[model samples]
Target: MSREKLLEVKNLKQYFKSGRHSVVKAVDGLTFDIYKGETFGLVGESGCGKSTTGRTIIRLYDATDGEVWFNGENVHAKKSRKELKKFNRKMQMIFQDPYASLNPRMTVKDIIAEGIDIHGLAKNDKERTERVHELLETVGLNKEHANRYPHEFSGGQRQRIGIARALAVEPEFIIADEPISALDVSIQAQVVNLLKKLQNDRGLTYLFIAHDLSMVKYISDRIGVMYFGKMVELADSDELYKNPIHPYTKSLLSAIPLPDPDYERNRKRVPYDPSMHDTSEEPEFREIKSGHWVLCTTKEFEQYKAEMENK
Candidate 1:
């Protein structure tokens, strides 16, 4: 399979100013890439800048430093409104909450058509209505429901509408910020399967951010584990699960519950203490193996490389 880079991020930083003296480094100099036609899952604990990273990538939040390149174009650099509008049509976001993300006052058709109108995808009113109806069916909703309000639908249906909205502009890349985290456990799988099917059919790339490791493993081709505003480990889903090298990555993996009752009972959770590592220097993200990447200090990087050599 070809591993063509669809999105490339280098030293991306998104920091929030708290006061004159304090600043919250939500995304502190992180870097990663999303391959074309691949879902790159980003899993991390709460308040670890996972969503912030997704927002930064989509240009929902302006970065304090670093660069984001999408298909060879630098997104963070200033562009004319026309250029920026063209960029917007190729990149879109699917927000986490189905309830809050959709406007309660707007009908489902109008909600989905917002992007279509902005991009002028449909030239006429009839065309716009037809496009919205088509999108509704594309996301598994009946065309009859296009005129209904968001409150009239279930959470899953609402999420499907959200997906349709994101798809309205025919975006090549999507940033799904914890797309299924707010959903019921039973509904999560349905949404994930829908996303996977859409990707297969549309050849869309995704930056799927979530806290659920098992779900991430199932849906993602590659996964990146983030902590405290930085990515610690990135590898193929199976490789990361089998050989998590960073202490933080190991801790996150150990928390995933197994399906087997016996294994679940015997599983031990690893606790991560960030203070144990030397935080004075900016660690380098290195490829210890052909595909596996990890962020580590000089000493730890040498140790990891040595261990990989032995293996």
Candidate 2:
């Protein structure tokens, strides 16, 4: 791992056993690096293990194999209880479902203050109350709103509360797991803008997991495309959008609706053929261009090279 890298995930795999003797590989030999202060977007279809990758990296789910290194230390290396607590303070996750993530029984104040209480962030009860109000204000909610329950707020407001809770621990890294998918389209931009502002203000690093290609392209520095359980392509946002290398990535880009009606009508949807795009044989992620890596066999890469040459 390099000194500049904040998080290094190498060959990470997460598998589950089902039936008599079958294994469902949710995350298969994935590798990537997140720098100190950048949003790395992970995009895929519903069951492609994008969320599993985020959870596994944060130690919410133990890896079946491979390493998740945070600041040059392997997070899965079995540390002491004290060390684990410290590790928890540095990393946090904001779940996809805002309605289910927050505790319905607890007041908004209690929910936001839970992490602060656990981490002993405040010296006394008065200090804790003040800190909770500060967190609420940071996410655009006022201090008076802290006494109310989550049900009182709308979907967008609830998601903001979840974001406030994640920020309570003063974490250096956050896994924003589909933060805006469930909200109304009108409000999605508001939440995304808030996240971008917060990232700039705090210099936070994020692993933003989502299926929205347009929003991902807007917020991410680099975008990674996944198929089945393997990473197919990774490159800078503009480069990937301008020149997608992998077939799976090309298909995903094609699906993003164009703003111009004439262009949308002229565009053809790319079909996903399982036979033509199979990863049964594990594909190795290799650097095909500067700062761009892809997973494919040598034969498949040659075919792509030939096609590009002809074009």
lDDT leader:
1
User: lDDT scores for all predictions?
Assistant: 0.92, 0.90
Give the residue spans of candidate 1 off by over 4 A.
Answer: 278-282, 306-311
Q: Which candidate achieves the best TM-score against the true structure?
A: 1
Expressed as tens digits, the lDDT of each residue in 6-32 for candidate 1 is 999999999999989999999998888
Native-to-model Cα distance after best TM-score fit, residue 157 in candidate 2, in Å: 0.5
Query: TM-score of every model?
Result: 0.96, 0.95
Instruction: Give the lDDT of residue 199 in candidate 1.
Output: 92
| lDDT (C-alpha) at residue 109 in model 1 | 90
Q: What is candidate 2's lDDT per residue for 87-150, written digit by digit as tens?
A: 9999999889999999999999999999898889999989999998998889999999899999
Off by over 4 Å in 2: 1-3, 277-282, 306-311
Give model 1's TM-score versus the native structure: 0.96
